[model samples]
Target: MKILHVDTSITGPASVSRKLSAEIVEAALRRHPDAELTVRDLAAQQIDHLSSAHLAAAQGTAPENAQVREDIAAGRSALEEFLAADLIILGAPMYNFGIPSQLKAWIDRLAVPGATFRYTESGPEGLVGNKKLIIASSRGGFYGPGSPAEALDHQESYLRAIFGFFGITDVTVVRAEGVAISEQARATAIDSARGEIAAIAS
Candidate 1:
């Protein structure tokens, strides 16, 4: 088995999402001892945001500039990494009720039509399959199912929807929210998320 771990936190060692994501990957390794792992630190590597050149290339237009060709190649590499993984672990932090720009850039690269999805008579069909996705999400405030802030949770919701578009519905989201509220809450949330990881790993 192969696992792709993508971390998009800019908070460095202070990032709860990064810590939880690492723990999640550790758990997966415990479950599948021989799993090969590939880690992509998006904040560090900084995937390029889609430009007009990429848009044109996606539409099958020939690259007129060297820079455009470079962008297209980079996008293709990112997409290939996603497609080759057996399991994907996303370390995502909520930024203003949505995903960080780094995560969004990675998503833009992978959401290539005819590569990740297809339009079928029934509807949009996902091209990627047989893989599991685990999202380790951190947020500043509590946004559980019944909470008032639940409606503000576009981070996980959007990820689920987009991955589903690619035919990956077997997704598990482990959230550690309210970390910025207090140290006590941060500890508690991390512990709770770790317990969930343990259960999943077993």
Candidate 2:
């Protein structure tokens, strides 16, 4: 199996999502001992945000500058990686009630027409339905079902929606919420998430 592990956390070692994602990857490795792993750190190696130049380039126009050329190549590379992976493990931390900008930029690269999805007479259809997606989600406050701030949760919800649009129905989330409530809350959340992660390989 080929596993694409993506980390979008900017907090480095202090990122709960990152730690949980690594554990999830380890569990996946244990399950598929010979699985090949590819890691993409968006924060460290950022993908340029989509632009008019990128759209023009996609339409067979040459990039206006060297930077645009490089950005286009990076976007293509990102899309290829997504297409090549059998499974994707994403470490996504909530920032201001939404996902980080870096993660959004990466998603933009993957949402290519006719590649990951296409228009059908019945409407839109996703082409990449065979791969599995597992998300390691970390939030500063409680945003799960029935939480007062649940409506404010655009992080996991958006991820689910986008991947669903890509035709990936086998989506799993291991979430560590309320981490910023207190140190004890953070520890408890992480522990609970780890417990959930234990079931991944079973």
Candidate 3:
């Protein structure tokens, strides 16, 4: 088994999402001892945001320039990594009620038409097959199912939609909400998320 752990947190050690994701990975490893792990730290590596050049490349209309070819290759490589993983773990923090730009960039690279998705007579069919996905989300405020801020939860919903577009529906979300509300709430949320991780691991 292969697992790809993608972390988009910029907060490093102080990031709740990062800590929770690590725990999730550890749990997964315990369940599948032979799993091979690949870690992609988007913030640390500074993935480039999709640009006109990338779009051009996706359209197969790259210029004669070498840089365009390089960018296209990079995008293809990123997509390959996503497809190659048996399990994917995303550590995403809510920023402005949405996913971080780093995760967005990674999504752009992977959500290519005819690559990750295809338009069938029924609808858009996802090219990627069944793979387990675990998302660890950290939010500054409560955005649960019925909370007032629930409508603002584009972070998890958008991710599910995008991944589902590619036929990935077996997704598990472990959220640590209200991390910035109060010290007690923050600790409690983290601990609760950790417990959830332990259960999932076991």
Predicted model with the maximum TM-score: 2
lDDT, candidate 1, 1-202, per-residue tens: 9999999999999999999999999988988999999999999988788888777777889989987787677777888889999999999999999999999999988887888999989988999978899999999998879999899989999999999989998999999989999999999999999988888887
Winner on TM-score between 1 and 3 is 1
User: What's the distance in Å from true for residue 177, model 3?
Assistant: 0.4
TM-score: the better of candidates 1 and 2: 2
Top-lDDT structure, candidate number: 2
Which lDDT value does model 2 have at 98?
A: 94
Model 3 / residue 53 / CA error / Å:
1.5
Question: What is candidate 3's TM-score against the reference?
Answer: 0.94
- What's the lDDT for residue 186 in model 2? 99
TM-score winner between candidates 2 and 3: 2
* N/CA/C clash count, model 3: 0
**How well is each residue in 39-114 modelled by candidate 2, as lDDT tens digits?**
9999999999999998998899998699989988888999999999999999999999899999999999999999
Ranking by lDDT: 2, 1, 3
Counted clashes in each candidate structure: 0, 0, 0
lDDT of 3: 0.89
Off by over 4 Å in 2: none
